[model samples]
Target: MIMRPPGKSARALLAATLLAPALATAQDAQGQNVTLELNAVEQVDEACRISFLIQNGHDTDIAQAVYEAVLFDTEGRVDRMTLFDFGALPAARPRVRQFVVPGMACTALGRLLINGADTCTGDGVAPDACVRDLTLRSRAEGVEVMG
Candidate 1:
C-alpha cells in the first residue's frame, strides 16, 4: 500500500471544514434576532416597576416596537395586559425600558408573557420581524418571561 499527500480537493475540503464555524457565526450575527430580557423588578411608590433590557441584533434599525405584554400573578393567573412601547431600537444596540404598573406589587408578579408585537415598524424590518424569532430571557428572580 502507498500513501500520498492530500489532493487539492481534499485540502479545500479541510479548509472549508476549518472555517465552517466562523462563517456560521458571522452569518448568525448578521441575521440575529431581537433579544429581550426581564432585567429587574421592584416596588416603588406602591407600584410594580418592570425593567426590560432589550437588544436589537438585526441588521436594520427599528423605528418602533410595541408588544402586547401580559402579566401573571403569583398564582399563575393573568393579572393584566398592557402595551409596552420599545421605541427606536437601533441595530446592535442595547436599550433599557421601564414600566410602572400602578397598584401592583412586585412580589405578585410570577410571569411575564409577550403576547405579540402590536406595532413593529422599520425600514427593512418585516411585519412580523419583532415577534418572529424573538429571544426572551429572565434575569429577575421569581419571574419567568416567555414569548
Candidate 2:
C-alpha cells in the first residue's frame, strides 16, 4: 500500500494535539500563583516542629524565599515572630520546609500568620512576586493559617 498525506482536518487535529501541551504550559506559567500550605505541626522533643508545603508556580526559580511569620497562642496572644527561609524553590515544583521552635508545643499554637514576604529573590522574579498573588492553605488541625 502507498502512504498518502493527511487531509486538512486530520492535519489540523495533529497540529493541535502536538501544540496542546505547550499552550497549556504557557497558560499555566502566566496564570499560576504561589501556594503556601501549612502542612503539619507536631511535637518533637521539647520543641514544636512546623511544616510548610510551598509550590512555586512562576516561570523562574526562587533563589531565596523568606516570609515573616507570627505564631499566636491559643489565647490569641502573640507567641513569637520569626522568619522562615525556604531556600531554592524551583519553578513549577513543590517543596516542604520544616522549622522547629524551641520550648514551644504544637498544642499551644492556635494560628500562624504570614505577615509578608521579607525576601523573594530570583532571576526574572519581581520584588513582590512571591506575596502578590500568593494562595494560603492549611491542613493542620486546630491551627489556622492566614495571610
lDDT of each: 0.93, 0.92
Best by lDDT: 1
Instruction: For model 1, give the 10-residue run with minimal summed lDDT.
Output: 24-33
Please list the residue runs of candidate 2 whose C-alpha ends up more than 4 Å from where it truly belongs after superposition.
1-30
Off by over 4 Å in 1: 1-30
Which candidate has the highest TM-score of all? 2
In the range 26-136, model 1's lDDT, one tens digit per residue, is 768646688999999999999999999998888899999999999999999999999999999999899999999999999999999999999999998989889878999
Please write out the lDDT profile of model 2 over residues 1-147, one tens digit for every residue: 989899999999999999999999786764656899999999999999999999888878988999999999999999999999988889988899999999999999999999999999988889888898789989999999999
The candidate 2 region of ten consecutive residues with least summed lDDT is 25-34
Per-candidate clash tally: 0, 0
